[model samples]
Target: MITADKFLIPARELGFNFFTGTPCSYLKPFINYVIDTDGFDFVDSVNEGDAIAIAAGATVGGKRAVVMFQNSGLGNAVNPITSLTYTFNIPVMIITTLRGEPGGPADEPQHELMGQITTAMLETMRLKWAFFPQTEEEVAPALKAADEYMKKHNQPFVFVMRKDDIAEYKLQKKPAASKKDFSITHTDHFELDYKARTTRTPVLEVLQKSVALSAAVIATTGKTGREFYEVGDQKNQLYMVGSMGCALAFGLGLAMVKPKLKVIVLDGDGALLMRTGSMATAGAYKPKNLVHILIDNEAHDSTGGQGTVTGGVSFGTIAAGFGYDKIYSTDRLEKFSEIVEEVKKNDVVTFVHMKTQKGSPEKLGRPKVTPAEVSVRFAEFVQSK
Candidate 1:
């Protein structure tokens, strides 16, 4: 068996220093080593999908990232893997443990089917993968091949790890104490007149003009991105297409890696509700350069205006509960613009919940720029000073 450092040291030398993933028994030694090491950064994501999105964000910010998770949770990561990484051509290394290896070891009944199909599932996703290096000599060649593939294709490469591939390494770091003094403050002024409330177009116009040129903007899927693109496409903007709920997590990753660059997420109510757990991760890390702006129209506007559960939900309370450093709620466009300006002046994780009318500009169209093109330019924009 190989020591965790044998693989990790070289991986770090090759620029894979940022790590994020959910915990797994097979990954204990590898993760422990990263946590204990001073040069590495490890983010404990709430789910495997969030892990992927975060890693992708880091990759976009010019950091080589590695995501680790168990095979059982691989299913949870498929959506972002296919939509976010594949569609955007963002490469990040993925190390997934083999929980239920056939004829290797008897595992829980739950891992049986997943174990049997783990490699098959990777193949189905069109992800290039290899069995993880088990011996000291195998480590270099394995990493070289994976690195070469990722650099060539600009897509994710997987390493399916068997149990006990790395020697045991204990964690020496202690978890940080929780902050008890922080409190949520809201500035709710929801206008009862729905007709008088501003629509998405005007809000996007304000945002396009308000945010600085160097700041990176991540627009969530569906109408939010479409409307933002329609308002004006900027080099600093990344329009997410298929990854519906990953904008905040992506922004979190970018914000963490590129702390000097402002990362703003344009989120929709339906999308935010789909991956609310990401907020918990944001709260925990509390990246000071990140800004979350939610335009809650209370309906799935892109999907034929189906009413969502957000009408009864108070997102300001939810953001507060999730540990956002700043929370503001407003329905008026002027107030929303003021909140955006205010958040830009602060060095804290902020959330703005804006209640807007439920319609887009008539005949709204998708961005002419392809997802791949957008990602390439966005990564360049992110890495630029």
Candidate 2:
């Protein structure tokens, strides 16, 4: 079996230090090595798809990232891999463990089908992949090949890892910091219809104005992103095009890496509800520069304005419960603007849940800049200082 250092030393030498993934038994040793190593940053993702999106964001932030998971969880990863990474031409190193090898191991019945189809599924997804490194001689070449392919295509390259490929690597310390004594509060009370509250336009306008040039803004998918673009696209703004519900995770990744740059996420109620677990993930990491803003329009404004059941939800209470250092929930535009301005200067991990109306401008336009261009521009701005 190859020792963990066999692959990790070379991978790190090639500037692949940012790591995020869901845990799997087959990947335990490698994950332990990554966590214990001094130069690596690993995020325990809530799911495989979120892991991919986080890695994509790290890539855009000028870091080479690796996302590792069990092959079975590849099903969870397919959406962002196709829609987010593929569509945007973002490159991330992918490492998926072989849970059910077709002929080698008679393991659980659940893993059998996944084992057989894992490589085939990757092929169908049009992602170029190679087997995980199993020898000292193979390490540099494997990473080299992945680096070349990713640099050329600007897409993900997979390393299908098999069981017993990596030898045991013991962790010397806890993977996380000492748990902070924090609590979450749940409060939900809204009494307003779409016609009574402020529309998304002004809410976005205030947000666009609140962001300083040193800060980075990430807008969630759907009308929220389109509306933010319509309001005003800036070098500091990144509009997520296809990775639905990934804005918060992306912001978290950016804030964690670029600690000096304030990273704010402009999230929609529908989109936030889609991946609420990401909030818990962000709270767990507790990046001081991260700010999460959720505008509750109570509808899928991008796709025909279907109503969502957010009026009954207490997002601030949820954020506080999720260990956010500060929470703000408001229905008034004045209160919303105040909170936005406050977070721009504050260093605490904060969440602002603002209740807003459903409608946007009559002629909402998509960002003229393409997703790839947005990623590059945002990356450049983040690293500028």
Candidate 3:
């Protein structure tokens, strides 16, 4: 039997000592070893996207980060994987535990599809990855190769683990905080230069407006994602890019997969405009659980603020037409807050529209948690349902 602890020492040697992820039964042995170790830094992320972002940020800061998650969390990590880190040249190590290898045994229905596509999806992203080493001796070299790819190419790498590879180990205390604390300065702020005569600003202000109201927030692709993450509690929120208005779609998936969680999808005019079909989908599903907030800035702000259909179209009318149980609109913060509060009482999908400015953050940083941490926390979060 391989001793998981020994493989970890090589991880330390390779300068990939920091770890984060959600635990999969397929990865439990390795997860236990990590949690039980004293020298590694492991964070419990809310989901795979959050973990991927965290690791991306850490990679930019000159630390190698590894994210472990189940094959299922791939759907959550896809946007950021392609848009944020890949577009920006940030490198991270990802490890996914394979579940439901056919004929090995009968597994849960949920894991079957994930098992089939986990590796293929990684390839679709063109990520350099490896499976868990069959022998403990191979772990060091495999990790070394992964680290080299990250440093040389500025692209993400992955290490897929199998059930047989990871064995149980004692939980370890989290490593002490590293000596250096890095903070990102925002050079780009999508702001409204002209102060509004009324309390309301443009629809983009919905994110800041929501945070001000202490409402849980999420941001979609492009500037909306960056601005929301920039303004909200970085640790609690989820953001995506290149999904191009599929924010609600992802949010719906999260809501359905995790029923008890109160999910708020911070969608933009362009994104919602692209995936308007989701509105009907959501209406049909009747996820009484989600509040779909559309920030109708009326322009593709990230893509140079091009005018959108919402400029002449009424989003509020659209929401009502689409069968939203409750619909609200506001150009002012006070009105925004009041409408959100009123909508809180409804047990159906609610839509909120706000006007925002056409500006993007100057610099963007990805999340720091590894893929692993996100899966672990997300699953735990879901289970708490």
Candidate 4:
């Protein structure tokens, strides 16, 4: 029920100046205000945990901090909070904008469960947090209470607010950046007219070459997974079932745990377009053994074959902006081999872009396993590391 300016002023007064996290419409007014202001340092972190880590580092260096994020990102923040902050006695204030509140008209089905579990998750971590303050007047006191709680406990505390309570602000859209192609050379062995073929053969050839050297691969949903599955052994690959555009997170966890083995992720244009922030997360935590191979088909081929933003959208540039040091693109096979060889020895996170065919094979069905089973397999894989 509080105005964005009101809470922001008190947050400033409390010495909480540094802000980090993903954008939320409900939190935009507060976020944009800090961004436009001269004094406040606002960083749009790749995920919630990155925000937490940034805030934690700032706190350690003698600055008060705030991390504002969507409740859906709580899953991503839990590890850092419990392992790094809680164990290390780091205190940071978290302000999360709640999405699907109970009794609010049903929101996107994808967010329903995440919404319901938000508070329970905080409790499970034994961290202190409170839902929407009862009135606009309560915002300042709630923040103060959380600050006091953090000081006393040396643990993170969260303030969750509903959509209706916060104000929205307009965001300035930047001009589109120049496009960069990730295709190197075509490894296609066939002699057909290369320009007319509908298959993603060139990209598949590159992925096959990568998998031949790597121990594990994770593919995001849509055409990338389909094509990667088409070219490589599914037994060594984790077919992402439901979580669209989350292959990097999977690869990050796997790579972090198993630094000795190579972890590859086959990402898609549509899938990456949906959640591009994962690239920043990929960059923040440098893992030498991790390789993200993006299969850019340039369309949402799995869902009615709609055109994607990436046709005009350049993921290669985006990866570069997110701090991927080794970025290469080519439409030819020699270039592909050059980039692949360069990426193989790098001791840092890498992103490879490969343009592919527009559509996947027809009659694709969901995996026979349930979400729980998929999670179990992923858990087992991570544990094996």
**TM-scores of the models, in the given order?**
0.97, 0.95, 0.52, 0.51
- Could you say which candidate leads in TM-score? 1
Model 4 misses residue 123 by how many Å?
14
Model 1: residues with Cα > 4 Å off, grouped in runs: 179-187
lDDT of 1 by residue, 1-385 (tens): 7899999999999999999999999999999999999889999999999999999999999999999999999999999999999999999999999999998778899999999999999999999999999888998999999999999999999999998898999999897886778665555668667677888889989988988585899999998999889888888999999878999999999999999988999999999999999999998889999999999888999999998898788888888888888888888988888888898888999989998879988888999999999999999998985
Local accuracy of candidate 2 as per-residue lDDT tens digits, 102-220: 77766788999999999999999999999998888888888899999999999999999888999877777764466577554566545566578898889888877766575789988
Q: Which scores better on lDDT, 1 or 2?
A: 1
For 337-374, candidate 4 gives per-residue lDDT tens digits of 67777777787778887665565556644455543344
* lDDT against true structure, model 1: 0.92
lDDT on C-alpha atoms for all candidate structures: 0.92, 0.87, 0.65, 0.68
Q: 244 in model 2: Cα distance from truth in Å?
A: 0.7
Q: List where candidate 4 sits over 4 angstroms from the true fold.
A: 1-198, 230-233, 333-338, 362-382
Cα lDDT of model 3 by residue, 75-162, tens digit: 8788778876676566778888778765556778988988888888889999888877878678778877887888898788888876
Q: Judging by TM-score, tell me the better candidate of 2 and 3.
A: 2
In model 2, the runs with Cα more than 4 Å from the true position are 175-194
